[model samples]
Target: MRSGGLKRLGLVSGLLAGALALSACSTVGGDQPQQAGQDGGQNASLATKLIMGTPNPPPLSEPVDTQIKRDCPPVDVLDGAAAFRAYATPGSADPFDIRYQASIADTARECSSLGVEAAIRVGVTGRVILGPKGSPGSFRLPLRIAVVDEKGVPVYSRMHPIDVTVPAGQTQADFPHIEDGVVVPIPANRFRGWKIMVGYDPSGATQTRASRAR
Candidate 1:
């Protein structure tokens, strides 16, 4: 009789432990999907849309004549006037398509005593659409970009060459590229607007020039 009682007690304890474990597991499983959904929501809120357009014609007659210059004294031509003319050439047999998009947010770190440290996340994608209607192309084009302040002063600049190939007769070739984030130490003084520009050369031209706006 005593042996039977001890056996029964052990069996009951084991069953209770199993039940508790199963309950804990079910609770954890139920919460996982909710957590994932919350993460997705956060990501959506953080994403900002960026739109790109050429406010004016390219600076130079040819893409090769385009130039980017930096750190000039105030009142100097930040970007040379002729530079625009160089890039302002007739559209290609297959027009080149370029787009610039950026996500801007306040950085956690402050640059000056006034808390001026700000960071902007920028992404640039360029595509060489072949044909008159901007159909897809088989060649990849190299590109250059710059970040300018509201006064038309260039604060940061970088170049990236992307290679993409589309089969002939395709309507479009999409080369989605992301530009690295830009962190600018804010000046103590108030400032105007900030702008970003991206350019491409489908003809394999490599010349570039830039100037700072006064």
Candidate 2:
């Protein structure tokens, strides 16, 4: 499994330690709510949803352009912006019909004095059954996953490029991706309203069209 680093997010003083320690938290499965607030208050849990087959999550508090600049990784060493633009463009021809989609199969969380840390581990799976041609060389699936509060404020977001290898004569692939160390501040009263979302990044062109349509 390939690993990508999370760009450290700015947080209030003193809470960073708790968030940092999340890297070593225990893992769990199933839908049971995990304990959050360190004060022994009512526990809270994160809700997970499928980005492709479900309703879209609330609009992001920050604009897509801003997110692209901060969370998106460079497509290449030079002409990085151009590379991203090209990659975001929906393919129009054969073999480009790779049905890309993902879901949050399981989740786990750990809490401490300063805040709560959750792991939004997911299974990114896809099949090339509809392709008019054969499998192309191995490629990276660019996935943008985010954790948002009830008011649509983002607690954590990252663009994880999962490398995929399609074996000869195979039509599908599965890549396990994890977004650990997701720091949610104390006062877990709102944890029940938080949600973890996974999906493709809105392409620059898509955003532009939406802007004009509005």
* Candidate 1 C-alpha error for residue 41, in Å: 7.7
Q: What is the TM-score of each candidate against the true structure?
A: 0.37, 0.42
Whose lDDT is greatest here?
2
Model 2 regions more than 4 Å off: 1-130, 188-190, 202-214
| Tens digit per residue, CA lDDT, model 2, 13-126 | 211111111111112232222222222312222211221112122322433233221322111111111012122235543235434322222232222233243323332222
**TM-score leader:** 2
Q: Model 1, range 1-214, lDDT digits (tens) per residue? A: 0111111111121111011110101011110112223343222111111111111212222222111111111111122110111122344222233221111110111111223544434333222333333334333344544566767777876655455565565533333444545555554343335544444433323432221121
What are the lDDT scores of the predictions, listed in order? 0.30, 0.34
Candidate 2's TM-score: 0.42
Off by over 4 Å in 1: 1-117, 132-138, 168-171, 189-191, 201-204, 207-214
Clashes of each: 30, 0
- Cα displacement (Å) at residue 78, model 1: 14
